[model samples]
Target: MVLVYGHRGAMGYAPENTIPSFRLALEMGVDGVELDVHMTRDGEVVVIHDFTVDRTTNGHGYVKDLALSEVRRLRVKHGFGGKWGPVGVPTLEEVFREFGGRTRFKIEIKRGGDYYPGIERKVVDLIRRYGVNAQVVSFDFDAIRTVRELDPNIETGIIFIGRIRWFLDIARKLRVRWLHVSQDLVDPEGIEEAHRSGFLVGVWTVNDGEVARRLVSMGVDDITTNYPDIIIKAIRGA
Candidate 1:
């Protein structure tokens, strides 16, 4: 069966990256969960997709500009696929503790701007120290490289926002375990190269039934999306 990742953890059901979404994904029977990690001012590995809380949270400001305690104070938008609830933002450790060994975690580190410090090292160290290496990812080459340096055997993938030859070069040089590409950026030949290079290929944010089925037909190793029920069913020809 094609491995199905809950893109931001059933984002279609709950606010993405929040505990509600992640737990909900497991309930939905997804193969794994994907979320982003951003560092708060207090050196906490918080689960949030944006560099700031402006978009998803009721508060405003960069996550790096806020403390973990302060970030926790703000309420996340309704992620329950209906009305909002008491659900709130969750730290990476909280998530790990809650979902560890339950499902795979594909953590994408948000390393935008120069404000985030120690995030790359801390994220890698925490996952490894806690033995959750199969559960991490990042668009930041430095972050990915740092993880590889810390543990060469760590399973890591490089996420490309858009198609670029440099990503392939970096993946090759780093011996990354997989290549995560945005669905629109996919090219048949690029995926073939990745497969030939001995790496899994995962496409992200894929919600359309047609695209999901098409990618499955393309023999992708993994598919990350918001609607696991619809997409996974489509992948299975259900």
Candidate 2:
């Protein structure tokens, strides 16, 4: 059976990457929760999707620029019309403490504008400390490679947005267990190729039931979606 992962912790129900969002995902019975992490100025690992807080929170600055204390003061802007709420940005430590043992965590190391030096070490250390079933994933191949170098036992994956001819070749080089691809780019043929090469396939941000069923039929190992309940039902009914 395909595992259901809540994309940004049931982002459709609550603000992305907050405690309430993650709690809702667990309540909905998701097999795993996916979240993004960036290092704050205070050298703390905080969960938030974008490199900056302008999009998701009431504050207006880059996450790397702000200290965790400043970040904590901002409330998540939920839904349309910029509604303020109780949910704030959560630290990675807090996430691991609260829901580490409850579910699997797919932690994406955010590497957009400013690179967080030594982030892999910090993330891997936290995963080990929490003893949670977790995997570190990144669009940056070097970051994934760094994770492998730091600890070969820790599961690592590479995320890609579009097609790549050397996909499996690169994955083999990186020695990664998973290949996380965009839902639009995934196909049965590609899935088969990856599995044949001993790589598990995970498709991200899928929300449609029909699409979820199709991916399941194609033999995807993991389906990351905003609505895990919908996707779980679709897979079960299929």
Q: Which candidate is the best by lDDT?
A: 2
List, residue by residue over 145-209, the lDDT tens digit for candidate 1: 77777778768888888773547778888778888888888877877877777878898888998
For model 2, what is the error of residue 181's alpha carbon versus the real structure, in angstroms, after optimal superposition?
Answer: 0.9
Backbone N/Cα/C clashes per model: 2, 0
Candidate 2 deviant stretches above 4 angstroms: 80-84, 112-114
lDDT digits (tens) for residues 72-142 of candidate 2: 89988888344425778899999999987999999999872238877888998999898999999999888
What RMSD does model 2 have?
2.1
C-alpha lDDT of residue 171 in model 2: 94
Query: What 10-residue stretch in candidate 2 is worst by lDDT?
Result: 78-87
Q: Which ten residues in a row have the lowest lDDT in candidate 1?
A: 78-87
The TM-score values for the models, in the order shown, are 0.92, 0.95
